[model samples]
Target chain A: MSAPSQDLLARMALTFEAQQFLYAEARLLDTQNYKAWLELVTDDIHYWAPVVESRERRHRAGHYVAAADESAYFDDTRATLGMRVARLGFPGAWAEVPPSRMTRLISNVEVGEQGAEDIPVRSCFYLFRSRLETEEDSYHGVREDVLRRVDGELRLARRKIIFAQSVLTARSITTFL
Target chain B: MTFDVSRLVDLENGLIDRRIFSDAEIYDAEMDRIFRRTWLALGHESEIAETNDFFTTWMGADPVIVSRTAQGIKVMLNMCRHRGGTVCRVDRGNAKLFLCPYHGWSYNPDGTLKVVPGLEADYRHGIDPTQWGLLEAPRVATYKGLIFASWNPEVEPLEEFLGDARFYLDCLLDRVEGGTELVGGMRRWIIPTNWKHAAENFVGDSYHAAATHASIMRVPGLEGAGGRVKDVVGYQAALDNGHGVGMWMASEDNARGGYGHLAGIDDYLKSIQDQLVAKLGELRATRLTPVHATIFPNFSIEFPFASLHIWHPRGPLKTEVRDLTIVDKAMPAEMKDMLRRHCMLRQGPAGTWEQDDMDNWSQTTYSSLSPTARGLMANYQMGMGHEHTRDDIPGRIDNKSSDINQRNMYARWAELMAMDPPPPQVPAACRSHSGEISR
Candidate 1:
């Protein structure tokens, strides 16, 4: 076989870069460094996690489930995201008062076409949270994200989380997925 | 399966036994006494706007299908009559027929049996379709656009059951001429807490906001700005039939759905202020701004968020929190979507204000399981003697942060629990088109 083309090598390098950026984000969230994680997102971030429902294949075209503009778990902008981070700092925020120990496992990184300012990346995440001795929750989902370059650093512009469960088993989703 | 209701729920002394929170036998009794008798809000009219549109939900432990036919809305048990399998397994769809997966038994949108696989060959067409139809709720009614159904045919009319609470419910539902519609789908999550905790919390537990949602107060415009957090100034109305509402004193800033922060919504409500006054009368239109309310057993409304919550009891120790966001039909599309999105910042499973609530609720349920904690009675003495009827208000009025409403709720709960279950009537589905039994 002939040597790999330069374009192919550049694509591979970009994919590696995108994978590393996501891994760093996972680390920040797992370590409960929400302030630092907030820094890695762009000023105009749109983080959304729409509610999913179980429906038959024939009902796919109908409003059997949440559509793009429908109900969601987290529909956060930059300002609202900052408020969530601010809430985590308060002692009276009882959900996280004892502070859940979390571990984020991210894999299956895939990079899309190189845009002028942003690159689309897809990854799977398994977020495990354990709190108060025995209470534990695990959320597994795929993240469709747009990573853009801002001030010579990669930052998250948009993230759309799609979960596997129809009904959330966890009581409250205080931490970001 | 009989227990002492007076011992479990003692509202006279403003005391409630811990056993009621985690008792298995009491939970089963509630399924029969409360869920089967009271009017349960299943879905909104907009959810099943067109004919054959449907959604599956739970009425207590029973799975139910809420569907719309050409005639009207029909609520029926989702189980198949033949082998007790669910005819409709999906969450929602527009289906003309629901075919049971276990067997090929099809049901019409109105819950009449449409077909059986071996109708011609097996038993030589012995089965009468009407007689073998799905079991349906005998009493179905709608207040505004919210559809409610009761299993007991002898149950009171919807308006009579609602009584004085309709005045407050209208503040949320009848604001616009076109009425309200849910914004897309629903959010459901499970929490380890008794369902009553959620219902009573909405009834008159604004006092918990200071400690439970202290973090939300720091957010801009939620409570107050510049370090002057607004104190709770509201009236708790303990109405008949166990319904309760908590309304904050209305102000010019709050006519915009209670928060002065939502400038866009405020301006929109202002443009139609005169129409509101005309529709709801001057006082109700301008003065009563309901913060939170519960229509007895489980259905709850949060006005500022424009959302409805159904605290479905999973067991004695767990609850399924199902929620829907409501919006005015006359509002502009952008404003409707904005209102839905704005509510997400403060409610739902991930909402800042509600996130802390689950911790409190679950812990309260869990701590009640301890042997040491079981011996003690929970306190409900706050603002007890302050309950009095106000001429302006329509119910037993109490201080905004009073436990009078809680006591009122428990009193009704005990009254219902002590009564015998209503005898089952012939299901409406078993009757022919002329309202006669098909047999």
Candidate 2:
């Protein structure tokens, strides 16, 4: 509504860079270059997507109530993910069999509070994945990431994914967010 | 393709009609004869610890409310007495009464009709207020902490139905001194496959592990507690009333074995060994190894993952798989956390081994409906007539590699289906607070 300020423009430029980094990460996943993608992750990363509860809108609005200390779809450390990523390469991994043809649509990127060690960013994602001939599965969700600068590069330290689809259509959730 | 329900299974010859997987008529009949009549697991007792505490779950496609009543736990249909609209829409909450949004008719946790907005002014016939209440499950019972209900009032007692399966169930439920508590909310999802595919797999099919989940076996540091996959020796127990259990550890003859390779697991288990013996005696406490099981119709449990399953049938071709994790009440926070992680990693919605099982099941459900496949029969002949009974151990025992569990379940299924029972008949209004179902 008003003339653009200098600090605001600088922050916009930083957010654009963060978006580019996320796009590059998505590109690596699309190409199935998991080994290279692993380098972009922090040594201590916590990737979590909790099992959501379908509750009344009286308190927590539709499917918003998630884990306190419960079972999650994913509650993985860097070491755990390393093994999982390694498993994707195996031929017997049926969920990944015929190799998923997928694309990540990442949008609404907004960099939130910046701490001394970490910068939090929020964005929404729609992962459209197809397998074999025509069995397609679409997953839409929001991701909150706490990224940190490591060796002059952004690395994910923590990621929490919240899905819009309460009843997952896919038979298996093997692909990453 | 048409199928006679009577000929769906031939356990004497170890043959199962492929039509059972995809036939619409048989699935509908199953809902009548089996699901409606048999005891269905609803939720755990710890869920509704406080008065008015409630949890909503499914017994098949029907929505059920398991509430902690002033008297005890009550299982009632979620439908309102007024226009049959869903009254308690929330998944779970602590509610004093369930008020119908359509007409504001409220019922207590015990299914008693508590409130009727402007009732005396509206009615001319002087309809008794007691006649209007929630439609509750005819029979509700709890074994350990698991709550189950059956529409058929004449159904066998829960303990009698569970029978020998209780010996193995105790291995999971009664392991620690205080027993286990559900570790938070459930992991519920829909899989496009017949419910029986998931049920039978958990009931009997350990043979798939070495082949189906071969990739998961290669995960580093996942020898899985006492080398479960490494030492692939165990026994499959074929229990009565279609319930069966498989214990997959080397030589389950004794109660003492490696507690697993986890740093604190061995010490924790060793600490509880004496208490476990005191609580459940030596044979039951030690003999039941951590493993996979099913309590006929739809309920399943995996002891190794500390998880439970209810394969609710959505239709002949779809299933809603609700998975939950349970941890010992007395376990340390860190151990509970690890068990949750382990449950998620191994058997939850995005689990390692379950992914493969889902794939096989998806294909089986879709392909079995073909004309050629429908005419053909699926085989369960691996050690078909080799089922043996152990006097020391309960129920019929068989080699882990055998199809005895599957045979036992199908035989029970055919036997039940032959009864040809009617679908449940619930009253128009609420049931009384005293656990009575009016005609």
Candidate 3:
């Protein structure tokens, strides 16, 4: 591939903007402003995090396999996620009663254009959570997303989350990653 | 105060001696008495479709290997016979040999001794590899598609043990033609809570759903559409041999209608209703919707959604849970996929409904650890002694909200614990009130 010209360099500048946007999204989660966080997603957003099998090395085929059709931790459309957020607001959503103290570190942004307005971006994340009287629960994963630039704002259209731990030690993912 | 098995539970009253939730001695006794003798669920047969395929899990605290060999399916202790190390560390896979990472001891898929590092040079008199095969469970049986094993060779037949619970179990497992296939990987996690808490809840705690899972029923815009939520209209059965099944439905078609949350259960079951009717008759086909049954100690299956989990007792105050989404083999892969997604969101390890449950269970377990709280007894007085049997459902059934299911489970638990005889003696100082320790 030829080196990027000045125009390509300018387009790549969007990478910095994308990183800033993710940081802001993380801040929303950390501050427990999940209601507002919904604004960052498109109306038709599809978020999924498939369950990972703990297979033997020989059976793994030398790579990690996460099937989209299989059971998952989170597979929410815009409506489902909205309900989920609304549920979190309910006093009966006891899992978030003493809402989990969360810190999401997003890094390693790799971005490319999907269409004129949609950008497919991939990044790694380390999510740390602390619940009532518990030390901490750490969850790390890779998130693949398609972000659409709607009216100069990047809105998540789709997300495919893959976690590092096939056998999760956390009691629950009380907070969004 | 230490464990006093005799007072661990009050046999006469319906009070569960809270110490049983955190006692080391009672936990130890249970490992030998109840867990060893009872039929515990391991995995579905469909999980290991091909020969050499295996699914690893726990039967209580002991790690067990369920593998399919050329001969047949084998359920054996995952511990190495040579040095007691884990023979197979992986969860599920196709493997030719069970190799122990510690001492390089390998066994065939059937757990027969294959190669032991340097067998030829190590001993002058050759050791008998024949006597060194993996310790297999004495009794292993399957009904519908769910496989269960018992450590006691003399235990009752799995069918006989399951008894009336079979009728309801068939509603889920036997619904599919070629039986059920375990879709999706097992979701395994740990919780600091007694296994009994989870087991007893599934045993029959239907009342908790209304207040505990209100959010699930009243999803955002669809608040009063109510999904599958209904008034207390179903029954709970304390089946033969300690097993219990709690069932609730809104008529026939609307029974499991709220399972997937996407396609609604009526639409999903409509295609399979004929098959279910042919297999289970009209009443069972439509009536048995949302079923949650626990096979005694820790095996639980949630129906329509088709999620099965085992609460493997880690200690008196800790548990390791492993779950999987199962679907009928004859169903289209897409529908199975949908059920898989539904089960995940509804009750997977980090599920919306499940997360709420973890909060209560974990907190209760933590509170019970305090010395001041260990002696208190939990009540099981919902519908004891006064529950009536239903005409359609088999076994002694009660209203969905009644605590009879929980009471009957403790009755069975008391029976099983009595079988082991109060551990010979309890420390004199640990004794408290009559049949209970009041710290």
Candidate 4:
């Protein structure tokens, strides 16, 4: 076997860090520790999940994927995200009154576009949620995120989710992906 | 097929049978009696503006393709005539021909059978192409840019069916001179609730907001924002043909809060105030703004966010809520963006207010499944005799919190379910261009 190169070792180290960060973040979400999870994102975080549609490959130019100004599932800023988290603590939040049991399985962590201050990361997630006895839902999607260094700590600057299903089978997307 | 609706719906005292939401027999009857006879909204005209542009959807459980041919908009069954395979599987596309991948059965945009593979060699041209085209709906119509279709050829005209509801629909569709268009593609999700639960909710169920959406009020931007304009009383209109609308009397108070609690929509409406008044008059444009309405059967409109809902019935216990956001074509890009964001914040599968609604509606449906629950009557007697006719308003006017609209809708459902279904029409392929079937 050939000697290991310095660049390959650096890429492997970055991948391990990204996987660890993602696993910790998923644990926070699973534990319903939204306040702690919020700390992992930058103040100017752009969290969005565009509507995925089924269209022919020939008409894939602008129709297959949702446009910037088109319909989206979660188009949130930090403040808006905070409002959602705040609602979880309210008494009348019936959707989460009983609280959904959720487990997020994150895998396929790959690094892309490594920059000095920001790095783009891609991963696949399988979110399983069970609520109120027999109601169960599984959400399979891929998340594209931009991780930036804020005060020497890794923080999520942007996240865009692309779901695999054209029609959302889950009743509500209460948990973060 | 006739249903004994007498025991199920008792409109005299505003009592509805709980079985209507959980019964398989009633659900099957709805497909024949209601969905077949009534006009079902498919999509907006702008969705398939160009020739040959197409969008696929469902009419009841049946898959359909709504396409625009050079002649006009054509809606046909998406199934191939040869086999039961879907011809056009995608959601939206621009295709002049829909070729079935099963055995290469191709169809024109107008649903006429175009070509069949191995026609000369395999079948020796024995099959007639005209008599084997895709099955098309009997009646298709459009009111304002919304396209609707019905399977009954003897169904009433769309305008007559819409009746006085047009006045309210125009408030949302024709507010500006340029008219409205759907901003982008639709957002859809499945809810484990009866379709009527969703339909009746939009049919002036203003009472559900306080309890069902209590958490939404705590949100900063959505605080105290909904169909009702702040400080202004709203009225629920139970129109003819089961259509219902809940609207607030347009007032100066609208300038402060009503536009779904968004910050800039009030100022944007002010900018186009004159244009709106000129187009819709003072009554529609200024004095009356319908917030949410259901046009019978399953189509619904929410004006605050300029979104439309099609509660496509999946079964007795499931509903596929398909939503499309609309905006005036004359509005600037910024206003459109604001409305789009507002819709996302409040109404899709992940909507803040809508999330709670799903929980309530699903639980409501789940409880109704018990035999004891189904035997009990679901009370709808909030404001029974209090419903009075209004000279200014065009329908039976009731208080915003009343169940008058729900009673009216059930009355209409019973009337439809009691009637004998129309005779089945000849197949589209076997019919002539003038719609006369020839042997």
Which prediction has the highest lDDT against the true structure?
4
Candidate 3: clashing pairs of residues: B257-B265
Q: For this target, which candidate reaches the highest TM-score against the unseen true structure? A: 4
Give the per-residue lDDT digits (tens) of candidate 2, residues A29-57.
88789988889899899999987766767
Per-prediction TM-score, chain A only?
Answer: 0.94, 0.93, 0.89, 0.95
Candidate 1 chain A lowest-lDDT run of ten: A59-68
Stretches > 4 Å off in candidate 4: A1-3, A61-63, B1-3, B224-230, B250-260, B428-439
After aligning candidate 4 to the native by TM-score, how far in Å is the CA of A23 from where it should be? Answer: 0.9
Error of 4 at A66 (Å): 0.6
Fraction of real interface contacts that model 3 preserves? 0.68
lDDT of 3 at B45: 85
The CAPRI quality class of candidate 1 comes to medium
Q: Where in model 1 is the C-alpha error above 4 Å?
A: A61-65, B221-232, B250-259, B425-439
TM-score, candidate number 4: 0.95
* Predicted structure 1: lDDT: 0.84
Model 2 per-residue lDDT tens digits across residues B57-116: 787667878899888888888888776878788778888888888888899888888888
RMSD (Cα, Å) of model 1: 3.9
RMSD each, Å: 3.9, 3.4, 6.0, 3.1
Which candidate model has the greater lDDT, 3 or 4? 4
Candidate 2: global Cα-lDDT? 0.81
Query: What is the DockQ score, from 0 to 1, of model 3?
Result: 0.57
